[model samples]
Target: MKPLVSATFLTLASGSIGAQAAEIGATFEKPCPFGDCSAGIAFTFLGETSIQTGFSEADVEFGGISGLDFDQATGRFVALSDDRAERGPARVYELDVDLSAQGLQGVSVRRHISLLDVGDIPFAPQSVDPEALRLGPEGFYWTSEGGGSSQLPPSVRVSFPDGKHLREFALPDGFAPTAEGSSGIHDNLAFESLTMLPSGDVLVALEAALQQDGPKPGLMLGSPARMVQFDVLSGKPKAQYVYMISPVPQAGVDGEKAMNGLSEMLALEDGRILTVERSFAEGAGNTIKIFMVDLSNATDVSHISSLARHEDLIVPARKTEVLDLNGIGLRPDNIEAMAIGRAGDGTEILLLAADNNFSARQKSQFFAFEIVQRLQ
Candidate 1:
């Protein structure tokens, strides 16, 4: 898909700025309301440098990334960007990776899945790009930008490495869907960030905030950021968890604090799920929080919800500061993409990627950390 949006509304102070830089427009494989495109705004990668686009103030090629996935069986990395960096009928590329040598600078042999010919679904809007994706038991599963227009179920697809085939995967009921009317329907949707567990369970982040297309245009935004499980074959949503972004220390989160923004979510193999919460709404202290929630033990995420009577389950996530130690500023915008991997010695690495909003003011960097197992 092309970048989510060509322009972004930035909230800046001398020390920090909170807002999405530019978003990649959603596109399928061919030109149409739904097609593959290369118009991207930001990128996240799993290489030697781990989300290392760390430029705090630099102009970047927009429409650079749509989503990312890593193959555990082969250590191969695939970053889906708007194909050809254009605005329609985009293609998905598969990158062969070897992090053993390079960091974010790792080398990748690339392949493309052209989506210029998939027949459009009924009632879908024009220019919807494939914004986010996940690697499923079947293959790659993704969501588009159309859940805003017609309640079209988030689009799911499977991409096989053979390159001769790319198929569409259908979204079944209960898997959870996103609603529009928030700040913008451009990048945020019903199921923006998706992840699958080794146990066959799935977690999806519904950008339950407003679906309007601008910066903080709404006085208020709301939605239950949901996580659900589905049967591999039938594609039925089996379970769900709902939660919220913390209301700033002063917002007094006495009501339903909305979980409006998220760049990515990763399902830990140990049954815990981690997420990057990018709240642009007023009163939400926007940060790249890596939450460690035990979804295996809880069925409903209401426990994680901090309503007037509930206590939020999200703990104070230990974040890797790319500033001071790294010179990156405090507003690391959208730094929540994740990957579960192993370092050379076999210790598990929780790799988190941040979206720098591609503005001339933030860092286009990524980070990798060892999950201080035992959660001390």
Candidate 2:
């Protein structure tokens, strides 16, 4: 692959809100540093920028962003804040991105919708940790990593544009919180990634291994993360596959491996999928990588409760590396959201957003890339 041209970073700050004084800011520039890229399927780093918005009209709360989705009908971006209403009410924001030949021109907040529960009330604080967002036939589909201390099981739910809950998906027993039984999920590690395929199937990926499956990732070896595919309309499971997670890149606090888990995925028209594997080093920053997964030869291990560590026993989905953000000259942050932009001509755009954790040391960042995939 060719090296990216030299560029400078730009930082812009906009005016504040009325009395609450919400601040909106952003910056854009580029300098791709990927090396020895492979062929067949690849992504060209278009550009990247850091964005911050605190508009009273938009009700934008600068917290960790965990999910992202695009509405082609209205050309707006829908984003989910991982906060469970602690900092503010659980909400989603619609944004408008101005794109030009140079790269991303600017970003503007359009609408902010607060999530509501069955009784038509705002979601109670510390109740649901919303993680993923997608446009569905009914309206917008969202997923939450249920609170572990409260023994709340992770869930997928649908709601109208106004944030009124329509229905919740029935999850498998294995996904219940640890307090439920021995086969449930680990604390803070549940359904973190979600995607809807073109074939009317929704894929939900577990953040880490289940209590009955195996242990979490270690210093050198990785752990197996399970992915479940189900009928979006009926919520009936159709298939399941194992996705191995790489170990943390560096040591963590109190002598533990930092963290490495599946963040998001994009279902392709050809049945295969592109997934993001994110790793965080306590002191080294983040390592975000994209893999193209081939499901043609994947085995459905739904019936098997505990997958053996035998090298030859497990047949996981085949993965091929397509992009790595570490080498792209952009500061690595917690990237939890990924989405595919509307296709134009024969090319498609991939958009990525980072969660800032509402910290002054961190930032809410965004990146864009163009993908060129040929029909095989």
Candidate 3:
């Protein structure tokens, strides 16, 4: 924990900035973990802060922030809650995250926008499980993992900034759950990651393997998860690739309880993506790892209905590990969201958020890092 400092307000001709700068009083730096560090970027741990549990605004309980996106034009962030309409209406919150040359200054909530259905009404309880979110050309694009037990299918939808329903994208038949458990996403493991590419396409990733793909990740064996890319205009899947999830980093007290999966992703300008893989064990806590995934040579498995049958016929996405939070000397929580932004000095920064599950023992933690690119 770091000492909290007073907030410094900044004003612009357009209006007053939403968040004020306050010092968190912590800093650290680590070089890239992979080969050729001189040609890669280093992560400078800036600072960290947390929102009090049970915090509320606009009548909505604020927690379960599973996805995030930075708004460069407005200098704000949109955080999506995976509440499933349990505490209140499913929603997204506008936040002002103060980042300065020194480090991450502070974070404040500005407003909450309730996501609506086709009739412009707020989603009913258990109807949708909103997860990953990203800013797109038309508006904000978000994902719903849906309820596997209740047989509610997963969805990717576009919503206006005000949270009004724009349209829902069509998904492939492979994503639909079946009563026999023969195919589709497993319970609570559907679309947990989403990103918009430079080509106006969007990609959504499953948190774990589908029933037909293989078994869930274990301490000794990894699983195969799917990443589907959709055409923004047609809302149709153009391609799908396999991203092999790592096995659980550590085993839990109960061997069957440990698990690992892909949680979030951010598309980069160089046709690569920054991926967040979160593994957790009941008593062992969490292990968060960052990887850069290159899909240039990945075989498109969209035409193949089942990856289990053609495991030897396809090429999975190539990935290179970048950062491991365990090695950074911080006890990470359930980190499920990631975003890229620029600090006041125009330096690229990386931000990560944890989903507390609204548990008293957990925390809504936020970590900031400066992306220091090294020269060759």
Strongest candidate by TM-score = 3
Residue-by-residue lDDT tens digits, candidate 3, 1-376: 1111222222121111223332233222223423544435345566777896789888778899899998877777789998989899889888877777566777788898888988899888889999999998778899999756888889999998888999999989789998888998899999999999978899999998899899889888889999999999889999999999998889888664788999999986655788999998988899999887879899999988888887467899988777776655567799999998754445456889999998888878898875544444
Q: Which portions of model 2 miss their true places by more than 4 Å?
A: 1-39, 53-60, 252-257, 308-312, 342-348
- What TM-score against the true fold does each predicted structure earn? 0.56, 0.83, 0.88
Better model by TM-score, 1 or 3?
A: 3
Instruction: Score each candidate by Cα lDDT.
Output: 0.42, 0.72, 0.81
Residue 323 displacement in candidate 3 (angstroms): 0.2
lDDT of candidate 2 over 287-331, digit per residue (tens): 888777776678888877667533457788877666566643455
Once model 2 is optimally superposed onto the true structure by TM-score, how far is the C-alpha of residue 53 displaced, in angstroms?
7.4
Residue 275 error, candidate 2, Å: 1.0
Model 1, 295-335: lDDT tens digits are: 53444532332222344453221222111111112334445
At residue 223, candidate 3 shows an lDDT of 91
Runs in model 3 lying further than 4 Å from the true structure: 1-39, 100-102, 254-256, 343-347, 373-376
TM-score of 2: 0.83
Off by over 4 Å in 1: 1-66, 82-89, 94-112, 115-127, 145-153, 162-187, 209-223, 248-260, 281-286, 297-333, 342-348, 356-364
